[model samples]
Target: MLEESIRPDNLALVIVLQACGILAGKEVPVNEKGEKTMALEIGRALHYDLRTFMLEFDNFVCTALLNLYGKCGAMIEAENVFMSFVSLDVVSWSAMLSAYVDQNCGEKALLLYRQMLQEGLQVDAVTSVVVLQACSALAESERTLVIARNTRKTAALEIGRAVHADAYKKQFAYDLAVGNTIINMYGNCGVLSEAEHVFGVLNIRNIVTWNAMIAAYAEQGEDEQALMLFKEMHKHCITADEVTLIFALKASCSMGCLDVCHCLYFDIICAGRETSSLSASLIHAYGRCASLKDATSFLNELSEFHLGSWNACITSYAGEGDCTSSLFLLEEMKLMGIKPDGLTFISVISACSHTGIVVEGAECFMSMSCAFRIVPEGKHYGSIVDLFARAGDFSRVNSLLKSMPMPSDESVWLCLLGACHTHYNVELAKYAFDHALMVQPKHAAAYVALSNVYAYAGIQDAICGPKGTN
Candidate 1:
């Protein structure tokens, strides 16, 4: 239109800006060079033309420009447009706050929020929702910081609660998006009850609301409750999305609810929503329910495999005591270039231990750190020790114990003691028993293993022998 010498009015420019904002919100297709294509360039051109037309100072146009730039990940340009506002209204402030949020600049959004409040502007529902999201992002950052510094002073949750209170005071709590954000904020803070309370009182419920509540239950290990809510959601005729299905599948897996799993699996198939995650969840659920055949069948139905799907199927086989199948899947996964994660190795190593494949188990354990760059955790160490102990490799067990960065725990000691009982190694059983007691005085398995060791040695009278007796 501009090339034809057609003069577009402010209304036309506003519509163009709105289109740009929508395009920015959608995932822009990138070219081979990883740069966004012509849509973003058109947005920039429209922005420049708005400046040329001197309509940039108009509040609505300015807010739209800010939104468009923010959605495009052009935070600097968005901030520039926001600063150009001669008089900031609630819409402008909200747009800028949303822009900061879109760019994941949560701290900046919070700072802008403080400035907005100081200006004594009346915050509306949209503004409240944006601020709540900023609070959520800040809460996540606080969690990361707490983990890094090993401190528990998290101000983000407090800020979020205050925001929630403010939303209620402003009568914005009834807004669907606002209510959902509040639920999500509380859920993310590990306050499931508060999330549930908010969910219960929500005058209107949507799929997002149900998903949030279900996810909260699933996250807190309330699988039964999550499934119950899912049923309730169905009664209300609310459709489940992929997220809802994922949470439901997780709850089913946790509780070994095979009936629920089968129902959800059929629903997924009918809906053509068979994602890798869902398939993985089905495999895990079947495995937990002691149906390795069903799990393997489900895994085979997948046209493509992700690392998670592979891991789940491998774990299912391992759990079924099918060590051969587990190892076979591991090799297949490697051949397919799906790098095994820690969980994969844990399952694979456990399978080797079960089948007494000592050499392969040791090689897998070593490859975790050597080839995969995954430093073995305590569980991996425990699995390897169990493997060696099962093979009666007492020297390797001792060497692994010494190589451990931290002191051995009760489980590790229990594994060693069990091996001693199996081999009638009286002296090593005494050592393992003492270490286990040091770690956990009431370790029942360790005590039982020690007793069995004495019985196997025909020294039943010395069951409660001297502390250091062999």
Candidate 2:
């Protein structure tokens, strides 16, 4: 029609722009940016033509342009097109939210979602999907950031629950994509029961659905349940994807089930799905389930040992309370010119704690920042604090707890409470018990531990009061 000089309508332009977005998206995956010169230039030329012809521009056309610009990695252009409209529509807002998520700007996506809701724009399933994706991304990214850089905590899970409530009210929860995203959000938040609710209600299930559910179980430390689902999927004749295998291997690693891991490894090899990451997990599983010799043999069988493999082997040694082996492997890893990451240090400190080697643990903790320039995570702090607490070194424990950069979690406080119970420090026990309740208000274990501390101190009157407040 263009060759014949036939005038194309706005609908025709939207179709072409949508096709361009698809092509550009193909060039760059959702989380990455790459040059899509051909698709980008063609989309720009179309934009020029739309303005030159003074053609009809409506929400459909604007949304199409927004999607094209978003896919081409031109978010500013997409925002301009979106803001050009006086009354924002659901599709336009959804497009921009998607752009933000695709551009790895989850916080921006969430902010825009709130603005859209404030404008009283009712959302559809598409909007719900993108919003949930943003929530999941924010939750995952913040968790990663907290672990990597020791930054602030995330409230994306609360926002996600609100969005989920709205989707349920709007009857958009029935959509498959929306349902899948809901499970993913719950999974990211470590809320397995909610994920299970969404999984049970989904009318149609796919491989992504099963994988999401399995991952949720794995993350929640319900390894047996995760493996059960892995076997259930096989019973349903659903082929396991690489992610499915990976999570299954992780479950096996945690369970220390060598036989199960061998089966999974056989499956991976038979399917020709062996990769470096899978091999790393295999090494980890071998170290956990079998002898260290077996794990070392597997490492030697590989063409090369990546940093992950070393970390896995070292961590497995630490987890098994093989402090000498873990320390030796750390030295070996350094000799190979491989630097240890934060995970490696956590294991090293944990191994030290297991062996009651406070001096070595403190040195490793200090080395995280001074020697390797790596910031300590909450777990690192928790491990070091536990090491000191077990040694009855209350002063160091107090100093570390007070100097913690980030807010303390329940586990860290609980570690202190457990120590106070053993050493019978009434003041420290009260402090830890209060903080534990502050972090996890319903932690019965904290109450029990505090009661033990009180019982040891003969504080019967305090126990008679409301939760030892007296």
Candidate 3:
């Protein structure tokens, strides 16, 4: 197609590019600036004029626009067009909400949906799917469950069940997407047993249904069940997609099952479908299992790789305490014309902390958002705290703690407290212990660590302090 020397405004050129985006679906690389620019250019050409091009750019065309921008991470542009209308049909709302959900902005999507609902907009299955995703993002929070459950009041489950019942009232509960979401809903609520029961009753299982069950097992740390379900899925003639591999490998990684991780890593490669994401997941699994050599070997074998793949490799190396390799990979990623994301930097910073690369880690942390335009999330700040704490720079750690835009999580303070214990920094340990208590008052592990700090510092008289606090 590039050989034809076609003009940018040509209709055929626009159709071909749009067709490519459709063909690639979710697996396509949207993080690359060049790829996104090309997609946007093609979309502009296809749509041409928002005012004049009236015939082809109907609801379908608008949906295509929403998808094109959404996939390319042009969410604001997508929303601008989406919210410009006085009247929105269900498909329009679904498309926009789906754009946000697909981009992992479930909070924003949910907010917009509630606004739509208040405005008397009706939601259908696709909208429900997006909302369920919002629920999943809130799964770890007990408050999230109460809010989601109470707000909907069984509406999500009931509406989904009703859809299935409407499909076949005699059998009542039979539909692929509905069953899939129900499993997901239960899984999100941490009701794994219920999820399993529903999953077992499914007469026909699609990839999504299988993935939901596998992910639920993984979330519950049921490594054996997760692995067994993968095998069962294969026996039942359900083909494994990239999602299945990622979730199953996550279980293997968490269990530190090096053999299983290695096997799945090879399987992904042997399947000859080398998405950057799958490559990253394999690297992460190997990293979590502490198999750095295997992770390195897998990364080196990738003939075609990208920034995300390299970031995953760096993350594994960092987690394995190989800061030199992690930094080297980060440099290599930049040299390959792929910009590092916040996650890439987080792993790199973690590598520095592991190896006590204080100056490098500090500089990276300071420049993270400035240089890479990647804002540091909680995980990144946690890495920074680890870096300072490892260097026994307690004051710097405390400064970082105070500077956080959001309240620091328990793990951040725990990292500081552990480092203080390692370096016999009693005063700092106490400070971190106090913060941890405030963040997570009922944490037994933090209390134990604080007790150890007091004992190690000859503050045995202060033992009463920790005991009373507990």
Candidate 4:
């Protein structure tokens, strides 16, 4: 249309912006040089053209522009667009909050939500859902930060409960979307009782409601409760989806309930769900239950497994300290012409490390590139380093450290530090500790490891000497 020297009216412009918003984050191709024709890029171009034409932005165009910038992850631009508004509307506010959630800025979103309430904008379902999502994300992220702070994940859950109370007072609590998000937030925060309370009061239940509650129980290691909830959902005639089954299986792994595992497995199969994608989960469940016979039986039932499924079973066996079985499965995969990836070797080598099969593990590390032409990544090197470190083979460890092409990072040095503590090598422990601090000055684990090393060495100072010196 522009090539014909024509112009879009305000309605056409609104429609065009809305269409662009739909494809905001997707990487649409605009040229061969691989630049993303993202919604933000397109919207900026259109905005530039409008400015060139000296056209005033109507309310619709302005709002659409904010949505476009937010959805395309241009938060600064989105905030500028939002701040340009003279007054707040719920739609624009919700878009801003949703964009914050998308950017994982949970704290920002919640602050904006509180401000929205102060502005006396009538809360709607969209705003409530967006707020709940912010609560959920804040709950999870705060929990991670709490690991460093050694505090309860109170910030997110407290804010989440506040949101629930506020939204409930506004009569938006019973809305399915808001209710489900409340359940999810509580669940993610590990507040099962609160999550259960929300679940009980929900006027309508869907697969998501049950899944969230079950996942809550499962994630907190409440196996029996999780399984009971799984059974109770069927009583409601709610069919289990893939996510529900995965959570159920996660619970089953710890409880060693083979019967429950089989029941869930058959339910998935009977529902005509594709078993291929779930093969690894099934194998893991059986392996955790310590029922190799059952695991083998399940493997037989599958038509064929891709490389990932085989690796899953191998990893399972390795984790269970069944290194022989892991090695056998590896050979079986080779016979079937399935190439093992770096992950496969990590598990296999770690198993060997635990079992003290040093020579075989060393051979496997050297053979990685020669046999499969797969270059080892840092993780692969870490596994090998761990194998040698745990073996108390300091000569080989020192040799490997010297020969490693990649620069030593905190993990590698910490691996050596751990072994030094275990083997009572004060000198090397001091070296490793210094290297660790040099790599990451504030790593909590590094300090803890240094403390451990000092105690093990019968050295009371717990102070560092110097880098690369005793």
The local lDDT score (0 to 100) that residue 235 gets in candidate 4 is: 96
User: Cα lDDT of all candidates, in order?
Assistant: 0.82, 0.83, 0.74, 0.79
Worst-scoring 10-residue span by lDDT in model 2: 145-154
Q: Tens digit of lDDT per residue, candidate 2, span 273-382?
A: 66778877887888778567767766666666588888888887887888888888888878878889999998899899878988988988998899889988888888
- Assess the local accuracy of residue 403 in candidate 2 as a C-alpha lDDT between 0 and 100: 90
Runs in model 3 lying further than 4 Å from the true structure: 1-172, 327-341, 357-385, 394-414, 420-470
List model 1 lDDT by residue over 87-110, tens digit each: 988999999999887766677888
Q: For residue 237, give model 1's deviation from the true position in Å.
A: 3.3
Please give the TM-score that candidate 3 achieves against the real structure: 0.65
Q: Would you give me the overall lDDT of model 3? A: 0.74
In terms of TM-score, the best-performing candidate is: 4
Clashes of 4: 0
lDDT of 3 by residue, 1-470 (tens): 44685333335433554684664354445564323655666666655543353533455556666667776667777887686655678888887877777666655766777787887965655666666665554443343434564545344444334433443443434467757877887776667887888898888888999999999899888888999999898898887889999889889988889988877876787788578888888888888888888888888888887666788788778777889888888787778777888888888898898888999888888777778777788888888999988888878887887889998777887888788888899877877777777776657878788787777777775432332464
Task: Check candidate 3 and list the clashing pairs.
Answer: none
